[model samples]
Target: MPLAALLERVSLTFRRQSVPAHSGVVTFDLGPATGYPLKLHLSTWQSDEPFRWESEADSVTIASGAFLEPPGIAWELLLATEGEALLQGMPVSVRKVIASAPFLGVELAQVCGQLQAARDLASTSPLLLILLVDRASATGMPQADFAEWLTQKQAVLCAAVDLPASKATAKLLSRCTLRPMIRRELLELKRCLNTPQGTALLRHHAPLCLEHFIFLSHYEGTYWPGLLPVVDGILENQRSQPGQSVWLHRQLADIEGMLGDDRQALRRVMSLEAFQRLHDRLLDHFNDQINQVGRAKLASELRVQYGGYPPAPIPGHEDILPITSWEALLQEGQRMGHCVGSYHKSVAAGRVAIYHLRAPEAVTIAISPQADGWVLREAKARFNEMPTGDAMRRIGQWMDQLTDT
Candidate 1:
């Protein structure tokens, strides 16, 4: 595919650069192009002393992976050129590394420097960093503020164990677990378990596995811990605790709803009339909108265009050609054989209007007057699958009430 098309589809930016010989470091700035930091390093060395090198081999490193955006075509291209450098007598390797989570247990600067070193080594992928905290470190800091601070970091997850439950620390743990993540990413940013007891607690509560599965099929081996039966001993034990069980049920219901398992979601939230009604309303609205748009194209009175060629209405409605002005709204309505009325309402921003079209039914439109043109906001009408001129005036009473408002 063309580069422009690829970039547009994947939301990626591409760039390339060369590192001169003897240069110690090379870095690229990819401001906001990436969600996570990317690091790439190139090193050159010579094993002069056969058995082992008496001194460390001289190397130049390229460190800037954090900036690489999606579908990293440029990075792959650059990495492929490593053989050219190797053939030049200097043994060289290109290392690609994923940056560590921004926040760590240790001093921030020192941790970053260590991560940078690891990225340059070409021995392993970027490491996952987990913070270890003792009672003092966990409690000495204001629990809520520290938790919030951790939450705001780019890629840090926290876990607190059997330590005396402070409200803030508990909140922090909740925040970490509740934050949505693909199973693989969740494992990557896996939070620290402060104590050995934390492990036992995790295993016991592990049955409460509510994961959102959007794109984990490829990484299922790494992310999918075997699924558990919905009603096993674990759920049965959880049922007595209303608060905990209710939250877990709701989470499961949400996942089911998102996965298009409406029947399952309804079973989970049967008592909550509002939940059922909300989902019903949403589905109904979607169906109505789809039907309306389909019918509109077949017998639409107004011809509109944001840009490009306006789509055809229908064979009989071909005369409904594109119009470019607010005046055309009424003219088109009349041509379509409807009683159209419009009035402007004054506002601080200038003037806005409500345009009414009385046909088989009445439609109301909200129009905002822009400097160069008018923009239609809320344009809606209850239209039928097929309509005729006489049917437009058949519901005169309803149309009159709609026009009055």
Candidate 2:
């Protein structure tokens, strides 16, 4: 029998069976209008929790009595049914409703290619494209491939009338985060869709979207030259106050770090005068550390001699200091003929800053206050035996040992 004929004959209805709290059994009774037999298999599909399903004749009872059924299990069961035997042409209204459903794109992924190909005859090309994009988003792609797809999809969407506010685009943007793996793809999307008009649309739809923020922060000047102007334009156009834009400042600092000009990046985004004050504050902090350690020594002596309620408690030095830029230190090293490569902070929550220098070695610098001052509390280099010119220079200069001024 044709699937369409089978579906036309059967009617599905639900029945409640008694059970405990958060548990129940629902019977699906498929009544054949012609008063004949029907056979259906109840197999588990993708499940969030365990469930028992049994089928007899034209009826099935799905039990969640053992454990509570997940929120969408019933719905999944209906959709996951292997009814290729009963599957046929859906009503125009049903197809439209399914097309608009949030999970429709997700559902499309599980359907047999033959079923999809059959549907292609009935579904519009644009609708299929929309489904394809959504499927692509739900199941990720290679970074390079995803970027290219996003670029092309964005262009198609630009000219598309029916899918102006596409769910696919929404899902993609929402899923994008400041993660290393997806950073390139997100950046590509931003570059493709973030025109002046596009930015306006984005600002209107997603005013505080993190994707834009992440893209700006991770931007590599070496890879995307002259992109700062684009970022500056976006920030300037926004109604947000510059002073209160912590994300802007932080991301700009990050981009600057990538560009090997952290201070310059900070200056462009933040006030140069403010950074100068911060530099002075940093110097003062080191001076204070030196004074505190000396006083600690004196207090130790007093404990031995004229011990009196331990002299005014010295302030503990900050473990992580963001007061000064790393580029400043690197520039200082460069001035002294120490070849510096790209720098990276410890990915873990530690105050260890690592520098790659021409000396062909990784210079690990730890920041802390010692008895003397806020010096390079600890410095070590993991040198390569066969060093490059840059590494050889840095090794010979031995600039890893930058101490307190």
Candidate 3:
């Protein structure tokens, strides 16, 4: 059967029903006219609860879903399993039509029309056609210009499928215009395609992932052979972490912020472990210097302003002194090798108060206002280690005294 005729026979209807708790159900009806019609129902929630789905076909219902699978995999799985019986003898082009229906939305008919028109193009690979159709649908390129657009994108489209088929590849192809620099990077990625590191880079092409790849490309001559592996390691480590791109972007931005024009220093990073260690060391040094300067200024201002934190009631074994200025907090953190120095904002905002215990054993304490009164949020000794039992007891007694007063 011709691709267009096959698509005509394959009917699809999409409807989204909104309900309470910000939950919704999306249904896709495929080939309702065909005796063996398939219906896929997806139940989505605003909470962390997993998505649930039900697939009904030929009076049999298969219900299953996953928390970890990417957003559209459920629909694809339904089509591959139960819908396969209906699509048995259909051309792969027809199969792509059914698979892309839910995502293509209103553009399904237009995309199908464009696909039929472009069938005579040099490369009509099903994968390439679906990719172009997706891109066209997203960009709203008119049918008149689609042929020109397809011709222009022909080289990149062909090259994209040469790499692995993954969400990353789709994102890279659909979102990015193949500029000279990006094309160069793509070619280099293709060269390493067979290796584990190369395949990983292809698979995990998040925006920050691409930016990191481009950033490393600048130092390619210096880091060669090891650069891709470093990238792969970073991606692998970040894969399990949520908000991976956000985390990666912040880390990279910090490096750029700390080093500025010192590309020479960045060139020294040769491995993923080394990259992470450098980021840590740079962050610590940056925070320490900034905190020192900020604290000194804060202390000078606090001294002039005169109003100070309320004095802590000294117990028998220990003296609890309120940390009235950023300078004192910085000293506490520096001496303890902990992050109390970073609490300057919270202290200034009056959300929390800090104190230092001078006797029995030095401990830094944080107390926040609660419904009743101030409560100890944390008490830590040097290096954020747990304080001794006696030290905690003294602190607790001081808190009780403060509450009573």
Candidate 4:
């Protein structure tokens, strides 16, 4: 049968099972009526605890392998029936978030024009701007954009709800520590739509909601509800204190570190020298054990430059100094790119500046500080290939011969 035909068959079956319409409209279980077979998931999509009380419907239901609402349009899901063809129901969409840092300036731009036209600016409605970021990468482009906007015009920070490992965001507000009023709203999103988190929630009845406080919960999986609430609360508190972007940036750093994606954490800071220090430490971490052909050559080059093998960390110096792990180097290098600086002494030796590839994802290339230094590196004299400067030198030599004639 065609996919549409199969879905229609399922939809008709679901509508038939739905509670009948009332006088004008029947009192119905809207949850089942909206979609035939949506599996509820933890709001954050990654929680492993008991789900919120709201996920406990009369029974978990699935049709054609999907845990969905009855009478609602069917959706394609990556669901597998665990056993008995249809899967059992579980706990679902429950979450919370609190702004962790002072965030009053977040939405200033959106409200700026509105505030300008108002008779009493202070009396005008206070709108909140909530920002969320995926900690998967070191470059916090989303968070940084939000911070820049806030810096341009300060605004109130609304509730920052962390999404659980579940794939929920707007719905996770119920889990926010700062506001209980948003619970119904967050839950309603789950009930209305069979989100992936909702599917996970219904299939696996675990804690769908959680407080978004950094360092509050242990190092769990990537479900993010914990950090948002702290950010939300911080924003709420910062409303009274204008101009606190620096503090806000600092807080982001703290949360990024807590999640073990410290590369992102460090990028949130404005300092330039941190990466240089990071470079030194990363070299020490692997203790010169560069095994691969590519990495081994890079290591050999470093040995020639630094002049010795790196010693492993001692007990006394270990805690006092930052851990120079490869992970850290990769994270920082990915964010900043390798630190390129002048090799003044090396330039005098006919070499260009030293190009340090701090992250594993980079290649080191030497650039002489002198203008002609690049030509020498690109010349066939250095390599067998017809390098860029080789043709240029031939053209120049021809010009000289013509002038001599």
Q: Against the true structure, what is each candidate's TM-score? A: 0.21, 0.22, 0.37, 0.17
- lDDT string for model 1 (154-257, tens) is 22322232322344333333333222222244332233233333323334343332222111111111111222223233344555342433333333332333
Candidate 4: segments with Cα more than 4 A from true spot: 1-70, 73-233, 238-405
Best by lDDT: 3
Ranking of predictions according to lDDT: 3, 2, 1, 4
Q: What's the distance in Å from true for residue 55, model 4?
A: 25
RMSD of 4: 23.2
Ranking by TM-score: 3, 2, 1, 4
lDDT of 2 at 392: 43
Clashes of each: 6, 5, 0, 80
Number of the predicted model whose TM-score against the real structure is largest: 3
lDDT of 4 by residue, 273-355 (tens): 34224344443332323323344465446446654432222111211122132333233323333222112223324343222
- Candidate 2 local Cα displacement, residue 376, angstroms: 18
Give me the displacement of residue 340 in model 1, in angstroms.
42
Higher-TM-score candidate of 2 and 3:
3
> After superposition on all CA atoms, how large is the RMSD of candidate 3?
15.6
RMSD of each: 18.7, 19.0, 15.6, 23.2
Over the stretch 1-405, how does candidate 3's per-residue lDDT look in tens digits? Answer: 322243355443332322342334445564443345655555432223323455666656744333222223334443444342323333454444434334432233233433444443312433345545555554656666665555644555544336454544444434332222322454343444424444444344434334344444333123234445556666667563444433344345446656655756666776778877776676588567756677677556644654454343232333887875556766777787656665545566666778888768888888878876788867778755568889989898888887787
lDDT of 2 by residue, 1-405 (tens): 432254444544332222332332233334343255433232222222122344444353222221111222233335444322112334352343244432432233223121334234224333333334444445643334433443444435433322335554444343332222222443345453434434333434433344354444444332222233344444556624433234334333334444443344343333334433443444344335435655345334434543333211122222221312333333322332221212223212233333333223444333444464433323334321223455445433433333311
So what's the TM-score on candidate 2? 0.22
Q: Model 3: which residue pairs collide?
A: none
Better of 1 and 2 by lDDT: 2
